[model samples]
Target chain A: MGTRNKLIYLLAALGGLLVIRNLYVILLQFPDEAAQGAIYRIMFFHVPCWFICFTAFLAAGVASILYLWKRRMVFDNVAVSAVEIGVVFTATGLVTGSIWARVIWGIWWTWDPRLTWAFITLLVYLGYLMLRRAIDDPTERAKNSAVLCIFAFVSVVITYKAIDWWRTQHPGAVLSFRTGGGNIEPAWEMMLLWNFLALGLIAAAVLLIRLNQEQVRREVDGLRRRVHEL
Target chain B: MRFLRQAGTIAVKDLKAELRTKEAINASLSFALVILLLFSFAFDPTAEQTREISGGLLWLVFAFAGALILNRSFSREQANDCLDILVASPVSGAALFIGKAVANAILILAVEVVCLPVFGVFYNITWTKRPWWLLLVLVLATWGLTVIGTMFSALTVNLRLRELMLPVLVYPMMIPSLMAAMQLTTLLIAGEPVTGEDIVWLRLLIGFDIIFTALGIGLVETVLVN
Candidate 1:
């Protein structure tokens, strides 16, 4: 394997080990009563997935701004790759959230504000992908989809604030390290930080791989077009 | 001042064309009325539930109608290759955006005025109780919708599935605005006292309008150029 491929494989293996460690802590080591018992184990996967999804979306927004500013196709590819990874993480978050809800709330789904807004976020990005597919011209597609990504970012801000504006059953935020009084114990905090770092690295690795694939596909298409012209 | 003059000319040109054709107004108003009628029948106009849901119903109709109007607002510009002409002109993209937004707001407001009385008749609700407040809410909410709608309409004008794409792009962003408007209107219709919370919602709406208007102004050049 080339040096780059070897490096990626090492990172991928490290990511896998971290995930395995997370499962071990949740299932065998950590006390069941830590988050109200064994039921809370879902947080090990769910919370990190959600955090990674939002981070990916924020990255997509930044990439979109860069694409619009520089008119670079690479930035557009980065934006699309980030969003596609975001969708995967979002789906993972949704399914894990459903399982958590079933165990805790005794139901699979409720119109609870957080759940509803999560669904809305999913739909909005799905619509973004559909909009990209509907347009044929590459430059036009990039411009339109960049605008959409920016708009979706703005909409997320509004949606996040909506629950506070209207009274809803969704619980207020749990962890706020920024405010300096995170209620989590030191051990749990360490585990959480490890999980977050590991998952974030995994998400970045996936985005890079997808971006490379997109570049290769674009190059192949260009070659085909050139051959046709000849 | 120069930009305003150019924008005014563009606005006037769109108004004159719309006046001669009357296509956008007719299609949007008819579609809105049909939605209202369907809601009336589906919800049982005489039920207490209908009274409670009237605010949501009205906003839903307006949202659909607004999308329809927005979709068509730019299609003609694209069809006649007038968008190319507009872009080539010395007018700033921001000015063009304002021109289109103002024209669309006027069209949507006209539809609301016509539909409001029809709604009252069909649903048997009295309209005279809080006319000023209701109108105020309508104007503010519609203003916010039209501004964002016009910007997206311009952005999506070049897309293949313009009709389906506009609403998918717009409605999710408009949810907070629609929710706030619906809640405020519900209070007004029920003769409940408007509280400080209502003002907070109004401020949210205004904030959305300002932020989106600024973003639209900044990015419209990008949209127009490519």
Candidate 2:
């Protein structure tokens, strides 16, 4: 009944409807490609996961900077929530990409520049989480992890630039759909955007839930400290 | 001027302590040598393949042995609560961080200097060609390692699992610099000329060193203050 809960339900319902509609088009309505066939359809889910991952990580980095600048617990909470969600989406992106690779590329994995950077990015953020678990004090945890978060974002930028710096076998983005460039069919491109919108809504709902959980965690910690004093 | 002096003094203080005991240097040098010998037994040192991988092997030794040296940069302050004293001192956190990073770089560079030749001897590769270029790569790459290593050392110094956490946090960040360093070192070790594309790796190395150095100095105050 709370406003936050109601918002979550609204977003989830909207996202679910869009997802069902997109799936109907993808599985039934849309025609197969000339070259890669139905297998290439995984790009609908695969690319959006990366989009969400990058978006969440960018949010985490900005929140980290805000936390360090303002000394606000709210910013730290946002940073941690964004990073946790970013990590899950990054894992999803990797899994989906790997399955696609197994079918298309004839191997489960390759050390192509993008793939290599993706794996390293996964490790780096996982390290960020581990660093968080290692510290006890809430303030220290926030400060230290914020610092690491900034460094991790730099690595992410380096990863993105790395694809340009090195030759990559991974297919380049078809996002030039806006300018009407690239080889993608117009229909596939439209479906991609629809799926992204749905996924983004779902991810936002999850983020709100995560923020609420973090609020509860802080409250519990406050109560435990008070109990210790009593 | 005072800030530079403060930084210099801290650097000298650590170098003097390291000189007195030589514990880290001794352990690291021996560890580096042992790894080199083990690498020789594992790979036929004289093989054509060995030359291709020698750069990677040499840096791996430095990285592993360097971890031993870097871990002490801040944890040494924990003894007698010296971290508190240093933080309370007139020197700023930036100075403390730079000084410690500088000292760590010097220490690791010394180990690398010794290990490089030993690595040459063990692997039967002539690393003496273009000594100046090799030194430049070593300096840039070593500075890159210590900057992140020392910063993370400070970040994790107070943690319960400091040793375990430092490497996990630091190594992923080091990959870019390490990749650049490895490629340049591999090419240099083989006495090849630096072509246009190889120049990118060197630029990346310098960029990494500069970026992390600035970040370390800017943020150390937050990390050091309780």
Candidate 3:
């Protein structure tokens, strides 16, 4: 097979392995917590979803900043694709966390700082996409949205900090590094590390597909413009 | 110095036009009044009831009215392609943004002059409240609202869904400030006194205003370019 096909196969295989391993680790290997029981299983996927979401948004914000500085479409493409993926990850995190909340906290939703901040952040980016859809010109859309993405990222950071300090309905921080490996158990941390890597790889794989798709779309758009000129 | 002068000039220009047309304030105040009247009827709850929610109700009106003012603030430039001309000029786009934001805040505050006392009477907002503290919160919160609103307004002014997109773009940004404002106002109006918690909320509002104002001046150029 060609190199492109090889890459695709590699990504596909990586994705499959990630799914299988995650299923095995979460379902079979993960011990049922004495306190939370099977419900604690959701923590594996839930935490990773948030990690991916934050990374995706951070990537999008960085790409947006680069797009503004470089004035390149590629950065814009990466930014938009990352934002889309971020939205997906954020949504998954919110929904699954809420489910876990219901199962654990016995409530479907609460004004927990993290949950509220995440929800507000989700709306902010959704607003970004909505603004994107409203504009017709592509460059204007990219430039304006990039500006917005950068600013929105700042807002997100502030929201996270402000809400974290504000009323916190959700649980506290996961990392207590100041205490020297204090929060999660060592084995649990090991499991979390593996899941993070696997999910991160899958995110990268999906991101590659999205970038390629955007490249094709741009090419098609260019070709159409040329044909119309003819 | 030049930037400050340019921003001031733009602010003067907007205020002068507003003085002549009175379109923005007229529309904004009318909207606020109607909303206040409608809410008074809708909630027509007892005195304590009105006193309790008056803070939230007042801010809700201000937020929507602020949106209307923002839309009008930009739409004025949309006339005869004035926005294009202004943007094409060598003056600072950040100045333009700040000028418009300052002008909107002033006009909205003008609307508040008309809206607040009426709301006070209707909702019995006058209690053992500290009016000066309420005014301080109002001014700071409105600054945060206008700066952020002005930025988003610039983003959407040239778009097809300019009006529809304003709230969607700005409301999220406005939440922390607005909530803080509402809480402080609630405390003041409820005769709860300005406690440490309320002071913290005020600090948060001030921080939001300062950070966003800095952000607006920095990013306004990129927004206006394309």
Write down the lDDT of every candidate, Cα atoms only.
0.81, 0.90, 0.83
After superposition, which runs of candidate 3 have C-alpha atoms over 4 Å from their true positions? Answer: A1-5, A178-180, B41-44
State which candidate, 2 or 3, has the greater TM-score.
2
Each candidate's fnat, listed in order, reads: 0.74, 0.85, 0.93
Pick the winner on DockQ between candidates 1 and 3.
3
Off by over 4 Å in 1: A159-167
- Candidate 2 per-residue C-alpha lDDT over A69-148 given as tens digits, one digit per residue, 9 for 90 to 100: 99999998999889988899889988999999998898989988888998899899999999989898999999999999
In the range B1-226, model 3's lDDT, one tens digit per residue, is: 9988998899999999999988887888889988888886786655567776777888899998878888777778888989989999988888899888989899888887678888877776674468788788889989988998888888887887787888888998888788888888888887777877567887888988888899889888888775
RMSD after CA superposition, every candidate: 2.0, 1.5, 2.0
- Structure candidate 3, residue pairs in collision: none
lDDT of 1 by residue, B42-81 (tens): 8679887766777888899998987887877777887768
For residues A23-139, could you state the per-residue lDDT of candidate 1 as single tens digits?
A: 788789988865467877777778788778888888999999999889999999999999998889889988998888887888888886577777788888988898889887788
Give me the iRMSD of candidate 3, please.
Answer: 1.1
Each prediction's TM-score against the native? Answer: 0.94, 0.97, 0.94
- Top candidate on DockQ is 2
For model 1, report the TM-score of its A chain: 0.91
